[model samples]
Target chain A: AQSVTQLDSQVPVFEEAPVELRCNYSSSVSVYLFWYVQYPNQGLQLLLKYLSGSTLVKGINGFEAEFNKSQTSFHLRKPSVHISDTAEYFCAVSPQGINSGYSTLTFGKGTMLLVSP
Target chain B: DAGITQSPRHKVTETGTPVTLRCHQTENHRYMYWYRQDPGHGLRLIHYSYGVKDTDKGEVSDGYSVSRSKTEDFLLTLESATSSQTSVYFCAISGRGIEQYFGPGTRLTVT
Candidate 1:
């Protein structure tokens, strides 16, 4: 079984300031990491994903994440945040399943990013 | 906005009543999923389907059932609504490369 843990429940940041959201996961086998954003009253949008290769993956809206295999961490980072970035961020993991039909996603509790101008 | 739509965006039902939610995806994806979101719990998968008539239960699937009759349609049914089942439900379609596109969500309140 795979599980994801989001350390912070909420994070507040001023516009143009840097922000980091921490995420960790537990899995015995290789897994795929993903970051999704949910705006108010909207569905989730994929921000980025780390499937293989590069440890540092860049995503849309100037967001990036570093995948640390040894530490079992995938932390999202943004050098400068904007008011539009205020939303709920979720970290998820998809562990390799027995077959292609058995894959599942395990999500964290989510971290609400409140960017104030 | 991956051409996914969930019908009856908001619904209110009493306990013991049966309710069904519909998810329609135009992407023609091979995989579809049903998930429920509650306060502080994030999103939990209720069920998923890999192909038509092929379904499997997830971590939280005791009170719910899902059916995929067509490639673009997945239906979620609650056998008997309960207070604990009051939450926002989202339908997702899996795209290429392990990415999922979610619906707008349906808010169901079981009083």
Candidate 2:
């Protein structure tokens, strides 16, 4: 079984400040990692995904995450954030392989990003 | 936006009553999923359909049933609505990939 853990339940930061949302996963096999964001009164939208290749994955809204296999972490980062970026971010993982058929995503509890002026 | 829409955007039903939520997509994606979002639980998959009449249970499939008679529509039903089932339900679509596009969501409250 695979699981995701978000270390922070909430992160508060001022506008234009750098921020990092920590995420760690437990999986024996190679997995695909993703970040999804949900604004107030809306559904989630994919922020970024790490399928293969580069360890540094850039996503929409100037957000990026690094996949560290040794640490089992895929933390989301932004050099600067805006008030509009205030949302709930989720980290999820799905096992990758031919044997893992019809695999579903396992998500962490979520981290609430609060951007203040 | 992947042209996904969930009907009955907001619904309130009493406990013990049957409730059904509809998800419709226009992108013709091969995969459709149903997920429920709670305050601290993030999102948990309830069911998914790979193709018409080909559905699978997800992590949290208890007390829930799903049907997909067409590629464009997937329906989720609660046999007997309960307070624990009150949450925001989202519909997502993917086309043979890991990335999924989500709909606006349906807010269902079982009172």
Candidate 3:
């Protein structure tokens, strides 16, 4: 079974400050990583994903994450955050599918990013 | 918003009553999933369907049941509502990959 762990429950940052949300996963088989962001009372939006080929994957809203295979970590990062960036972020992992049949995602508890002005 | 919609955006029902949440999608994606979100728990999958009439359980499947008779509709039923079941439910669709398009969500409360 694949499981994801997000170490931080909440991260408070000021506007124009850099931030990083940590995520780690445990999976014996090959897996894919993803970061999703959710605004207040809204559904999750895809931030970025690491399928293959690139260790550093950039996503919407100027966010990016690096997949470190040895460390089993895929941490989300931003050079600077805005007040609008305040939201809950989730990290998830799923096994690499064989021919279109893939397993469901295992998500972490999520990290709340609180950006202040 | 790739044509995914959830019915009864905000519902308040009494305990022991039956409640059904509907998810409708126009994208006709092959995969549909139901997940519940709560404070400190993030989002937990309850059920998913790879195709019509083919459903499977997820991490949090107890007290919840799902049915998918058509490609565009997936229904989640709570047999007997409980206070523990109060949470926001989200529906998602995907096309055989990690990227999933999510619905706006339905907030359900049991009092």
For model 3 the local lDDT of residue B47 reads 96
Assess every candidate by TM-score. 0.97, 0.97, 0.97
Candidate 1 wrong stretches, greater than 4 Å: A97-102
Question: Model 3: per-residue lDDT, tens digit, B68-108?
Answer: 99999999999999999999999998875657788999999
DockQ of 2: 0.56
After superposition, the stretches of candidate 3 with alpha carbons farther than 4 Å from their true spots are A98-103
- lDDT per residue for candidate 1 within B1-100, as digits (tens), equals 6899999999999999999999999988889999999989999999999899999999899999988889999999998999999999999988565777
Candidate chain B TM-scores, in order:
0.98, 0.97, 0.97
Q: Which candidate number maximizes DockQ? A: 3
Tens digits of lDDT, candidate 1, A41-61: 988999999988999999999
Model 1: number of backbone collisions: 0
Q: Give the whole-model CA lDDT for all candidates, comma-separated.
A: 0.93, 0.93, 0.92
RMSD of 1: 1.3
A19-104 per-residue lDDT for model 2 (tens digits)? 99999999989999999999999888899999899999999999999999999999999999999999999999988983222447
Q: Report the error of model 3 at residue B105, Å.
A: 0.9
Model 3, C-alpha of B33: deviation from truth (Å): 0.5
> Candidate 3: deviation at residue B92, Å?
0.8
DockQ of each: 0.60, 0.56, 0.63
